[model samples]
Target: MTMTKIAFFDAHSYDRDSFEMWNKDFGFDIHYYKERLSMNSIELTKGKEIVCVFVNDEISAQVIDALVKNGVKLVALRCAGFNNVDLPEAKGKLRVVRVPAYSPHAVAEYAVTLMLSLNRKVYRSTQRTREGNFRLSGLLGFDMYGKTAGIVGMGRIAKVLVNILKGFGMNILAYDKFPDMKWAKENGVKMVDLPELYANSDVISLHCPLTHETLHMIDKDAIDMMKPGVMIINTGRGKLIRTEDLIQGLRSHKVGSAGLDVYEEEAKFFYEDHSDRMINDDHLALLLMMPNVIVTSHQAFFTREALQNIATTTLQNCKDFLDGKELVNEVMAK
Candidate 1:
């Protein structure tokens, strides 16, 4: 049997380690590339049966054309979100499969981590303590108990987060286009509209996929509807919230604090070290300067368990395609 050739782009040390560890079972001929998949890097896909990519890799229409020209049969996404992929372009040319659910707990827990860290000024406090300044003047936080938490999108990760937040005695208000009434009732979650969730929630955590209708969903208008000093947490796609609008909200104090695991224009900066360089993006620079905001480089799904699951599911996706089996996790253009 000929081993399937997979070109893994945007390869990190951890990614290589995890995938290589699991590739033994599938016996795939995997080639790793540190650079992200883009027009310039499209040549790497030549002669490969599949191209594996991550969240930050570019899978534009042009890239799709190049992949098809390169004889690539499959595009295996190691992550859940496929906003980076040009689904419409790849529809007839190539099959796209993704790890729909790697480890929901990893992301859900990270969202909670950001909430707690922001509320308690954990990051600030840790820095101050290290400097031998024990003054607790700015370290103020409210009890999570009895606070209203509005969860945008009750997907797998959101459901896990709901259970965790419920333990804190939080009133869960959820908003999903297709609300699962049965699940909401069983979980003690109140299904509300976006406006209601924005108005009532003391803390708002976003866990929705990015779509045309949902693009810039948390713009100035939405921010205006939110409760004063509402804490915002986004562990989902960054484009879901408009960065400039969010900066304005933070500046005006409409948003008390923000915890972001992703950024709309993070492809150039995130997942890479920029400590030696200056951040040219003014909006991102302003956001980083804000004490009330915490920006993470999309590391919510960085847990060992999640990485393992991603590798396993991603390889299985390729194997399924090669075997002419049903591609259960295959995503289509809508």
Candidate 2:
């Protein structure tokens, strides 16, 4: 029997470490690539049966076609979101699988981390203290207790966040197309409409997946609906909030603070460091310059536990496929 070969793209040191450790159980031949999977890198998949990709990889229709041509049978996504993958094109050509629920607590806790860090001006204070300028002049933060937190999306991560916010004594207002009424009632979370959530929440955190209807959901109109000086935190996809509109909102004092783990154009710059080079993306640069905004490089799901789960689940997905068993995490076209 031939050993299974996998071409893993957008692989960092952490990814290589986790996958290599986990591959001991499966004994698959894995080739890790530092560069993202793109048209130029399609040649790497020539002899591989599977191509494992991270969030930043370019998995377009053309790339999918090339993968099929290169004898790639599967495209395994290491991350939850599949917005980057062209599913329609890969319908029959390629089988796609993803690690959908790897350490929800990691993301939920990160969302809360961003919220607290932004609200308390922790980043600003730390910078001042480091420079020997500990002045308590511009650092006034509101109490999380007795505050309203609106959460969009009632997925695993959102539920975890709800529990955390409830512990903080926050009134939770959640909006999900398919609301879990029983769960919400038990957890003391009020299921409300988007408009109601927008109008009432002191802090709004986004956890929804990026879809056609949800793309640019937080634009000028949504910002107008929100409370004055609202704090926005996004641990989900970046396109959920329009970057240009968000910058305008910040400048207009409509959005008091923003904690972003992802950005719309983050693919070009997120995982890799470009501190020495100039940031060509104007919107990203502007957001970074803002005192109230905290931009993270999409590391909300970077916990050790999450990495292990991702590696195990992803390899299991491959094992199941090769064994002709039902793939529990297989992603199919709608």
Candidate 3:
């Protein structure tokens, strides 16, 4: 069967390799575009039924209209975040599908990895050991067992995170709009309201989406409600926690440490190396300067298993849309 061609925009070195390795079984005419996909790149997707996008691509209303005009019917996002996509504009214009929960364990484990690496100062100690310095000073870390973990959002990633922490006997306190009471009971997790979760937890991790209601949810008021010296981890959307408020928390000793995998303005510089150039974003620079803060380049979902699953799902999403079949991961604009 001759498969429908799919144009993969922002097909970086890593992205192309991962997609090619997993999508060999699927009959897809994959055209790779290493450059970031913008409205200007709409012509490249012409005659293609689908366009697969990455984290860096701009899929706004203008781009959506352009894609439709260029004969693209479906937009498959390999990543989970849909903030960049103008869903309302694309409503009935083009089908939008995403790999919503591809390898939740990958992101969940990365969150824990950040927590442990920062808590024990493992990265610092490893650096010193390489220099033949056997100093244990300033490397103290508290036990995770018996510690209280407050998880915001009880989504797939958050559920896996809670389960991982459960192995260490960590008490889980969760907050969500539609809290999973059954899961909480089964896991011995306490589903509390937001304010209590903030004020009482030893470690607070955000696993929520970025929406108007959730924007800067961890601002000054939320930070003020948090326990002093509490550790904050955000492996989810960056806008959930205000960077300025986080800086204030770090400076005021309200937040002991931060393990961040995403940032609000990260689309500008992330997935690209700029060693020779000076940083243009002051907020990122300020966060980087903090000893108690650690940032990863939105890499919580960068594991091989996750990438393969994402690629397969993305291709399938495109195929489904072209075949006039129901899209399992379709994001319908309300």
* C-alpha local distance difference test of each model: 0.95, 0.95, 0.88
Q: Candidate 1, residue 35: CA error in Å?
A: 1.3
Native-vs-model 3 lDDT? 0.88
Quote model 3's TM-score. 0.96
Model 3, span 117-207: residue lDDT tens: 8889888889899999998988899999999999999999999999999998999999999988998899899999999999999999999
Pairs in steric clash, model 2: none
Candidate 1's residue-wise lDDT over 197-265, tens digit each? 999999999999999988999999999999999999999999999999998898899999999999999
The TM-scores of all predictions, comma-separated, are 0.99, 0.99, 0.96
- The TM-score obtained by model 1 is 0.99
Looking at model 1, report the run of 10 residues with the lowest lDDT sum: 1-10
What local lDDT does model 3 show for residue 78? 91
Question: Model 1, stretches more than 4 Å misplaced?
Answer: none
Per-model clash counts, in order, read 0, 0, 0
